[model samples]
Target: MTTIKNSPRNLAVTVLERINRQGAYSNLELNQVLKRHQLTVADKHLLTTLVYGTLQHQLSLEYWLQQFTRRKLDPWVKQLLLITLYQYHYLERVPAFAATNEAIEIAKWRGNAGIRKFVTGVLHAALKSGWPDFAAVSDPIQRISLTSSLPAWLVKQLAAEYDLATVAAIGQAINEPARLSIRVNRAKASLAQAQAQLAAEGVQTQPSHVAADGLIVQSGDLLGSQAFAQGIVTVQDESAMLAVESLAQVCDLSQATLVLDACSAPGGKTGQVAAALTKPASQVVALDIHDHKVKLIQKNMARLGLATRVSARQGDARQLAFLADGSLDAAVVDAPCSGLGLLRRKPEIRYQKTFRDSQRLHEIQLAILAAVAPKIKKGGIITYSTCTILKEENDQTVAAFLAAHPNFALEKTQTARALKADRAAKTLTILPSDYGSDGFFIATLKRVE
Candidate 1:
């Protein structure tokens, strides 16, 4: 039974408007709104497009509409017109007449009966006028920033941090819906075997750039699919799989190596770490700071058929007590971060992430590294990683840790070879452009006893 409580377009418009005006998180509000109604797959897609697309190119739509509307309409009426214009101008499939008609129908709810005619007129005018060329403005950056719907500060930040072209690439990338990638449950089958099973089930996969366990899906909900329920696959991001692969590269599993997945949560990487080891392989201990997430880790381990050797524990990374100093094989400290690198997957992050989160998380990241470093096996590897792109959470935090602990040494990444990096740096910070993946930082270290 479908669970559509309201019309997808109407629900999406209401949600988008409320999110803009009330400062609600789009995804959260969208999910809450969805829960109130049961929608079909097509409606689901439409609603997603209406919400994310409206949010993504809102400034461009508004700027173009402003050039056509004569009288100042109410905010709601203006938003309806903009929504209609977004479809009319940008979306090729939606016919101009249907968009204008639907928008006018929605405008009838407003107090003025005359609003319908005004909306119809403005939409047609904008459609015929065909968007503005704001590049001729005095300051082109502001024009680009608003037209691209990116925060101006972020535009300057990325342009300075990366290059002008890369910043533009990033701005374009964040607006696209994130591609789905699936993680293979190695305890049950190899990635090939999992792919074969999914193929027979009418789902296809491509080999991921990183992680022997990673697969870029062709189609289907990886979690809801049969392969997933049968413990054949897991849903994960390509970059996150890279973080796990980085840890696996450092492991020498011949001996009884104790691998620590510190700060593990939602356990995708934890499952990968456990699956990285072979039979009678090294013991992998996945630890999370919270008790509830321990179950999540355990569940993932079970799904991957790793429950026998991989251990999931509820413990804080700041003060881990179960392991001895310098007595482990390897440690994957996938630290908690501001998640700046993942803005593409979660479009709302551009607005949600603040500098304060970085300042606060820096302390927690440093503390976790210090506490977990002592637990690493002497001369064994410890890979510190984060899903964030900011230098403060990546290199700067790492610099502080290295200064504090002389025993730890910085290591390099061999995978980010194509990154046109000229400046001298000690850490392996993989830019999205480097591997055609999301930006990430992975620093491999070894404890010199």
Candidate 2:
């Protein structure tokens, strides 16, 4: 086993290299790197800023870089230049000379004289040229794409659905850091109790405006706190929690109820559902397609002390042969989409996802909904949700579902109250810019028989 020396620049470079060359996910790789190395608070901040900022702005950075050098550079060299340019353009506190010197030093340590010279030349050239004027791009979609560091395809798609100004605002909103929100585990502690516990440990938090059991952590190391370790609180975005809460609002789970989380893995919402159920003798069965994910759900449930309430199962959500029709009291389908809503947290998704991916996911989402719709009892609730603002996946999918199955109707009143959702032909869409949360769409439907 080998370990890289623990320096902010080295750690950032290593993470960036893997992401750029090996197609690694930014958040997962960053967590693994942070756990393996001991870094000071300042270094941790610097490493995170560099990795996310560089990836988020890579497209714009590359567009700028092409102005200076048309030569094809090695991936590592490109990563070095990207981070250097990111600091030059974004981090006003870091002087251009210091950023250039750090890049040169990193190059010398990691590469030969030729590479060092190449890096130095690129940095000097970029500094001399200054930033590109995005206004110079004539096309609105292309200009927004370059300025916001979003893909042109995504920009065009969003622009077609919304006005160009709204698309640009959405793009700009996702580039900023996401706010931290956590769900207080009511089974273990009250929201007020959890807030006091977190405050005693130097972590300040406020109640979430949307979720009844949610608290927004203003500042603190939440993961390292006792509240999190002991399951007094669980890290969850307000939008994700609201999806599960929306189901609870319309469903009658006050008796001995059986609920199903159709695609529950790494079960954040499963825990929320389990805790929100008012029935004393209720059961929440969480199912995932893969065995490892089932285990992950089970492990998360155990940590939150929800294992006894929520059972984990491994099966294809598209085929639930074991459960009979109209057996479940309620169901939640947090279907997989392109993850466009999570760009703030997962900055690399903009480059990785495509419009085609959303098309493919729509089929899968409809299949899961078809399979689970029959499982809910008459008059029971089925909440379809996705972490994307795209209409194709949200309203369009639900519209297709309703057209096929007239037995279920949208529970518009409940969804509006729970999500503060705008009614869009029978569904709700929560945009990140509008809600100040993840871009989530949730539609609650009731089996009318």
Q: In lDDT terms, which candidate is top? A: 2
- Tens digit per residue, CA lDDT, model 1, 1-449: 43222666567678877776787878889889878777877878778788788777776776777688657766677667767777876779988787777676676654467777777777777777886887765564576576667666667766766666776676666666666777777768887788888988878789876555678887855666689887778888777776666655566544546788888888887777676676485678888878998998788777767787778888888888878877678888889997767766555566656777887999999999999888877777778889887777888898899999998888664342223346477577766554556678888787886
Candidate 2 lDDT by residue in tens digits, 44-157 = 889999999998888999999998788988777888888889999999998888788878888888888999998898888888889999999999889999988999889888
Which pairs of residues clash in candidate 2, taking residues 3 or more apart in a chain or in different chains?
A: none
Off by over 4 Å in 2: 1-6, 413-425
Deviation from native of the Cα of residue 385 in model 1, angstroms = 1.9
Q: With candidate 1 superimposed using the best TM-score fit, by how many Å does residue 437's alpha carbon deviate from the native?
A: 2.9
Q: Pick the candidate with the highest TM-score.
A: 2
CA lDDT scores, all candidates in order: 0.74, 0.86
TM-score of each: 0.86, 0.95
Model 1: residues with Cα > 4 Å off, grouped in runs = 1-5, 21-25, 62-82, 110-125, 137-140, 253-256, 278-283, 416-426, 434-436
Report the C-alpha displacement of residue 344, candidate 2, in angstroms: 0.3
The clash tally of candidate 1 reads 8
